[model samples]
Target: MNRLNMGRACARAGLSLVAMASLSAWAQSGAERLALAAAAPRLSEVVVTAVRAPQPLTDVLADVTLIDRDQIAQSGAVTIADLLARQPGVELSRSGGPGTATSLFLRGAETRFTAVYIDGVRVDSQSTGGAPWEAIALGQVERIEIVRGPAAAVYGSDAVAGVVQIFTRQGDGPFTPYVGIGAGNRRTGKLEAGFSGKQGALDYSLGLQRDMSRGHDSHPGSNPDRDGYRQTAASGRIGLRLNEAHRVDLTGTYTDMDAQYDGFLPGLDDHGLNRLATLGASWTAQWSPAYSTRLSVSESQQRYEMVPTPPYLSRTRLRNYLLQNQWKEGAHTFTGTLERREDHLVNAPIDQGRHQDGLALGYGYVAGAHTVQLNLRHDRDSEFGGQTTGGVAYGFAFAPGWRATAAAGTAFRVPTLYQRFSEYGQPALLPEKGRNVEIGLHWGQAASRLGVTLYRNRVSNLINFGAPGACLSPFGCFENAGKARLQGLTFMAAHQVAGVNLSASLDLQQPKNLATGTLLARRAQRLLKLAADTRVAQWRLGAEWHLASHRWENAANTSRLGGYGLVNLYASTTVARQWDVLVRVDNVGDRSYQLAQGYPALPRSFFVGLRWTGR
Candidate 1:
């Protein structure tokens, strides 16, 4: 089918799903709805990344999503990127299978535009301008928070598109230990163990995981050998409650990954090595009922290298310090923060370092039916003088379980050190800036919910590779020669019917480059997702459907990437009073597709695992 016909078909399908959801909601009896609501667990009611502080989900004015530990386990995803791609307004691209180069686009923005944090500690690569998603182990994460819009006003830089925060397990209650083992196709295997507990005034949690796989050939046209990978990861969190008003916390994580891939020289064996480590420490004090303060220090190290014939190595180290104060009185809350960030990069002939000092102020109000939030921040960079950003949001609860929200924000991202000092760099390039506005209507009651959001974000001073002129490389030079407009409408619905939980989301977007009047590379104009889950006897079963419209492979719109659909299924059950069993199958149809031009998507695969928890 042609692109136009495919797009129309997707649109019709989306409409049909929406209609079905509405009809089901209307047909449900009041008693059934109430029963569904009563049975629902209040697991994810509070989120912190939306406003840099913990707030109830209903009071938040920004677009956000929360994923709990149970959701993570049920996802049956091999990597963090793979799980994130299942979310609305998010997309993923990979050059190969697990433990390979990967990119995530939030709201159709570049990977670097999204700021990522692990346990309140920032992790980024100055060489690539984004986090190393492939190196981060998914088994160690306990919770995830995603904010889906520009947030430079809250975070200093690298937040033009959104912000993502990952949290490791924290200890509570009595001592608990768990172990899990799994095996799958492609000679894949995994083993994980963890323990968490709180004793007296101290709490601690630690986990370890290892994974290995003989993956498929990523680039079949080049080398025919089976690409393989191995990974090892560990995470720990410890907290000390000195007193009722004072506390201290420490968090750390480390991961090492080695993957074999086809290089330029086909016959020879080549490998890529990646390592990441992060450490953070913080202290908090509550002086009074209305006042509190926190101080934190964190550092992250990232290194990547290619072996043998094409020897290459790059390392990035980032350090952050923050002092925060919060005051609360009646229905108003205020915050003041002072932060410092230092970045250092070592790549071949270039070793560079830079620092930024920032001050931020914020205000939030939640009274009766009205909610408001405002934020302002200023950062002085060692190389680029100063940049200021601000945002405002307002929400009004007009009726029972109905709310209207409007928000506008400004964001910016400074050029990476490698983008300035490398062989293809340009020292005089300006920082990229973004302006965004959005409005949403949401209604929620019990187990039924609906939301519609419309948004438009424009970016200026965009950077692209152009003809060689101001750099040492003859092939091309980095230049600020592009502009982009990303506009979209998203619809989401959730309803329970006949003991089954149903959810659907549709995203219609236009991510276009103004310079060439064409669609951005690897971004679809339409996306739809549907999911259903139910429990029968002793087993819980779930299925997911994912669909996307056609996309362009390049900015010129010369090459086309066909759209595809995939079905995934998962089932879990508990037995022997202490063991949990899970089975999952992905790409059920064995459909052939590609995320990148040359790379092939993973075929139909199955995995089964057994986990035991000490009671």
Candidate 2:
């Protein structure tokens, strides 16, 4: 791979200081100050995924994106996949429409390289090492933090690409209730209702939602009949403050989905039943203003049943225990965590189980215009023995609103159950290891923010299913015989001018196999996202556009999926004191596209809904 040179861009960015200085002077003259005052209040924007604890985004050294509740509701997105498609340094591929199998590639890395978390608990499947992105409903999410780069030093494994953490919704302020209903193309319908409240020492939130859609043909040539999907999801949380320095919390989520799909060989009416459930409890205590500790436990289960000939059911369960402590003294902070995770898998074709234990240490220091972070961890897996990872990050502020950051980290991923214990399994396969480095620049003012990041990552000891020499033993077996490299640059910008909101992001990447110099599969070299929103009178109008470059569908670059662009429009307005209406048109141009080689994307569609907010 050719080396990347960013000298010219860096020089131009540095030259912008003159313009910023002039703008600063003009702001001090008065009118700009009033404009800032009239602008909406900014959220604190504290992020926890970067450092494993809450810290202001401005002080973090990693490239991170924050998607808050208001943005979720305003985006007119129904699933996590819809919201993630527009993010920087991310690409998605779905086999079909909603509730189907989906894959997320981060910074040109494979789907399994990323680790997903919900309320500080890992949610990826132990059998496949992939998260059920389709089943994670947006209705239960309060916020999402997407941290790009390696994070195995703080989290254990499968964090080579990045870490995506989701915080569930909880009650705040006085009692409030909400309900919504919507209908769209393809006989799609939705119903949702929720209530939230907080008493003197008790806080709680509950939500229920259901959706059904008669989706278009997944593979037109094979099956012309429409595939259908139905899903029901529920989430709840409760917290009790026993005293001023102690608290207890409980949270849970459940989702069930039934989906119809076409088989690879044109078998129609291929159906699947998917179910997921997660429950967690935590106890927190503050030893003083400077010290705190938390103990938590969580359990999660995932099941999938395929119906038709040769029907089978696969189930995986996980139980986790965690103990964490944090201490703050002057300009320095210290943290320590000990965790144990056990995974149990049951399958008609294969049955297996595994356990892992890990310990981590972290340190952070903030003083004047300098910020530094350090982390180290050691994990012992029942099958892979022990491995260690670590990282360091530093940030320095040259001006009031301008800063530069550099980070480097190492990560690893253990082989999945299917890879180790199945019929074609190779129990001797080793874990995959990765190392990465990145440099970033951030500039932000009143209503404007810009972030730039350049990163390179390399992985070795990668496990693959087909190994010529080794496969001879079992006809096809897993082996660690692959090495890959990913290099990329990400640019993100957001600005609020007058009453309009504008945001854009671009990603350029090179993903290659070191052995053959072939491009990786399903990873686009170029991705662009643009969005604009403005409020006129009492109505809010928004538009979004996304463009992706052609990508290879096969690792050898044999089959390719052409690039495509899509546009969407949204409008919302208040109908009454506590009632609001929303309308959205997706794929406004009705363009034909494909995320996968043979699968077809959704066509132009429209939806409208009414929501009531209780006071």
Q: How high is the CA lDDT of each candidate model?
A: 0.86, 0.80
* Per-candidate TM-score against the hidden true structure: 0.95, 0.93
Model 1, runs deviating above 4 Å: 1-18, 22-44
Model 2, position 12: C-alpha lDDT score: 49
How does model 2 score by TM-score?
0.93
Give one digit per residue, the lDDT tens place, for model 2 in 1-615: 344344444344445432332111100101112123224244335678887776755456666667778778877776788887777788999888888888889898878898887776677776666787876777778988888889999888889988888888889899999999999999999999999999999999999999999988987877677888999999999999999999999999888988887775565588778888888999999989999998999988889887783486878888889898999999898999998988888875667888889999999887877889899999999888898999998877777666778889999998888777766677788899999998877666677656667789999997766754553354678878789989877666656667777767767788888877888888887787778888988999999888998999887899989999999999999999999899999999999989887789888989998889898
Determine which window of 10 residues in candidate 1 has minimal summed lDDT: 23-32
Best-fitting candidate, measured by TM-score? Answer: 1
Best by lDDT: 1
